[model samples]
Target: MAWLSPAFPVGGFSYSAGMESAVVEGHVGDGDGVEAWLGVLLAHGGLRNDAILLAEAHRVQGEGQSLEEIISLATALASSAERHAETTRLGEAFVKAAAAWPHPVIDVLVGPVPYGVAVGAVAAAHGVDRVDAIAAFLHAQISQYVSVAIRLGVIGQTRGVSILAASEAPILDAASSYARLDLDDLGSATIIADTLSMRHEIQYSRLFQS
Candidate 1:
């Protein structure tokens, strides 16, 4: 839980995952919109993609698969430059902090890595259960976006909590579904979210990175 905590220093608070653009476009104007946007993300967008990567990384590490291969695939999966930056920056930070704790598996990762790969590797090295790791990762992603909405004044504190609460079932479902998916099964249908993320790159007066 410490790894996924808001206070973990992953610099996650700086990225809005395209919610800022969505807000500017008026696609997400309130708590309900925030919840709906997150629902789509958790169900079919970056969150789903990350969940699959996390699960596959966890499984591959246990099966003696090459970490380099996983990292390469993950890096390729990033849909945009900002998305790539987000994962790599967060992944690098996570690996640095996790290395201080000295995990034999994670220590072998020499250079930058993707966030999902780093998470799965560290979780496996630390003996965290696959299910728990995926769930926590999804929850952290959801919480980050919700926090973004709150910061944008799209949702109040109580309503943010409520939105998160309402996401519990969907998060579990996505985790469960993604856990059974293989690397080849990876795909995303969140065109709007992806477009917004791309558009965020040139957004003026932006408060978040992406």
Candidate 2:
């Protein structure tokens, strides 16, 4: 639940991961667009690609699997310089909060533990099973996307929440399937979002950090 709360001090509020660009282009500035974008994320790239990795990381932590491999795979899969900084930033935050739990693996993978791996580790420490842990991670992800979109003025609270509400089943379905996929299958194709992130780099004026 800590990971899902928007109030968590992970600096997640500052980054949009390119939603600003999409908004500027009028492509994602409304409910329909938000639905479409989130649908695409759930149906294709973001959900399966990234959420699966999160699930795997959780399972690894649960089953006494290899931390090295999990971290390596997660790092490789967690692309985007800004997004990487974003995830690592949150991971670092969680590290501080999770100190009392004292997982050696968490200590070792402290700095850039790949968002998924870190989330999984934290979930395990908190005694959440891998599946539920993945659900929380995926829920947080979709919520963040919606939150960023709202910050971009692409949607209002009702629409933003509707977008999240609409995405729940797909996110859960995809996450469940993804949890069973291999790291070799991990990859994202969020072209517009990724490009928007690049565009956010040069956007003359913007409200988001990307």
Candidate 3:
């Protein structure tokens, strides 16, 4: 929780994962919309893929394998320029802050690591349960998007909390399934989310980075 929390210094509050764009374009307008949009992501989009990467990273780090391949693949999987920046920037911050735990995996993570890879690798090195790490990571992501929705005037605090409460099943399911799946299963089908993220890159006025 501390690692992926809003106060953890990943600058997560500044990125919406394209939620800002979704709101601006009317793709998401209220609590229901937020829930539905996030549901798609958790099941078939970036969040799903992130879960897979996190699981793989956890496995490799636990086995003391080099993370070069996973790192490269994570970067290459970004759906857009802003998406790329979001993951790498957050990953860098996560690694920097996670160094407080004093794990050798931190030093091994060179260059721009994706957020999932950093979290999974660090957590694995510290002996955090694989399932717990992925589930927490997914929850943090959903919470961030919920925050974005509230800030964008799409939902109030009460509604946002409800949305989070409602997302428990999807988060758990994704985490469970992805933890068992390998790299070959890493894929996203959330076209609208991906396109919104790309459109957010060039959006003339925007509150979030992506």
Candidate 4:
């Protein structure tokens, strides 16, 4: 819980994972819209792929295996440059803060670990249950997207929390299923989100990183 919390210093608050662009484009303009956007991410987007990566990282660490390939794949799977920067920067920060748990896996993270891999590997080293960790990670991700909506004036705080409340089922569904997935299952279909992230790179009046 602490690892994925808002105050964990991962800077997750500063990046919207392309939701900022979605909001500006009027694709997500209200509470229900935010919820639907999140549903897409949970079911078929970067979030789903991240869960697969996290689960793979958890299994790799639990089995005392190298994370080199996971790290590379996670980086490669990023749909845009800003997306790549967001995951890697947040991952490096997560590894730095997660050092409080004192694990050898933390030491092996030489550079630019993807956020999911960092969280999953460190959680495995600390004996966190795989499904629970993935659930928390997914919850954190969705919460960040909701926060982005709130900050963008698309939804009020009460509506933000309401969306979060409505999101629990999808979060659990993705987490439970994704915890068993392998890298072969890693793929995303959120083309608009990915395209918006690239568009965000050139958006003149951006409020978030990506």
Candidate 1 steric clashes: 1
Q: For candidate 1, what's the RMSD?
A: 1.0
Over the full model, what C-alpha lDDT does candidate 2 score relative to the true structure?
Answer: 0.72
Give the alpha carbon lDDT tens digit for every residue of 33-117 in model 2: 8788777766665556667677777777777777778777666655566666666777777666667566676666656776667
lDDT of 3 by residue, 51-154 (tens): 89999999999998999999999999999999999999999999999988887788898779999999999999999999999999999999999999999999
* Count of backbone clashes, every candidate in sequence: 1, 0, 1, 2
Whole-model Cα lDDT of every candidate shown, in order: 0.88, 0.72, 0.92, 0.92
Q: Clashing pairs in model 3?
A: 18-210
TM-score of each: 0.97, 0.88, 0.98, 0.98
RMSD of each: 1.0, 2.1, 0.8, 0.7
CA deviation > 4 Å runs, candidate 2: none
Q: How well is each residue in 188-210 modelled by candidate 1, as lDDT tens digits?
A: 89999999999999998899998
Steric clash pairs (candidate 2): none
What lDDT does model 4 reach?
0.92
Error of 1 at 163 (Å): 0.7
Model 3, residue 78: distance off in Å is: 0.5
Candidate 1 segments whose C-alpha is farther than 4 A from its true place: none
**For model 2, where is the 10-residue window of minimal lDDT?**
74-83
